[model samples]
Target: MTLTRQVVSFSVIGVCSGALTLVIYVMARDWWSPVVANLVALTAATLFNTEANRRLTFGTPRRRGLAHVQSAVLFAAHYALTSCALLGLGVLVPAPSRTLELTVLLTATLVGTVGRFLLLRGWVFKKAA
Candidate 1:
């Protein structure tokens, strides 16, 4: 059941994130635009991720004010790391078109995504002992 939930949860989130990525890429065309777009997407994902992660990923109830705040802070750090990577890729790639830039950024983002998921699993979304 847990594995099933994890797969389903990840799939849903992936689809949601993909949709946001497409919209953002179309709306903003530039080397660094995806970074900006990612920031926007991250904000949206945060809210969705936090709630979903707690219940589905960790079986954690909706934590109240202070715990929520703590989780948000941790999530910010995790998100910033990935966002910065994408921005750095934008600078490093020197791509001529937005499509090319996004390609580079997405490659970088893949590494960051794994890191983020591990961190969230081990730290942010872990069940209380």
Candidate 2:
């Protein structure tokens, strides 16, 4: 059950992120486009990511408990890391080099996705101690 929920959660968010990136790129060609796209992605990621992991992945309810707090904290950390990674990568790779821009975005997504999975598995969405 948890596995199924996790798969769905990840799938939805991943698709949304890809769509968001394409939209942002189409709308703006400035250096700020990547930043804007990432910010939007983080918003969706944080909300759905928290709810899915807390309620579905861990089979928890939206009640006041350690799980709730843990979920918020975990999602917050993910948002922070994602924002930093996207911003830093933008600086390192810049926007004119579309290849580098895409690579950095992909790398940041890969690392952040792994980190979120691990954190949810070991801490936020784990069996309550």
Candidate number achieving the greatest TM-score relative to the actual structure: 1
Model 2 ranges off by over 4 Å:
2-33, 62-72, 87-94, 97-99
lDDT of each: 0.60, 0.61
Instruction: Compose the digit string of candidate 2's lDDT tens values, residues 4-98.
Output: 76767766765665556545553453555666656665555556556655654556544536655775675566557656765787666554475
Local error of candidate 2 at 41, Å? 2.5
**Candidate 1 lDDT by residue in tens digits, 26-117:** 56544435556666666665666556666666565545454456667755775577667666765776654656656655665455556655
- Worst 10-residue lDDT window for candidate 2 reads 21-30
Every model: Cα RMSD to truth: 3.5, 4.2
Global CA lDDT of candidate 1, please?
Answer: 0.60
Q: Which number leads on lDDT?
A: 2
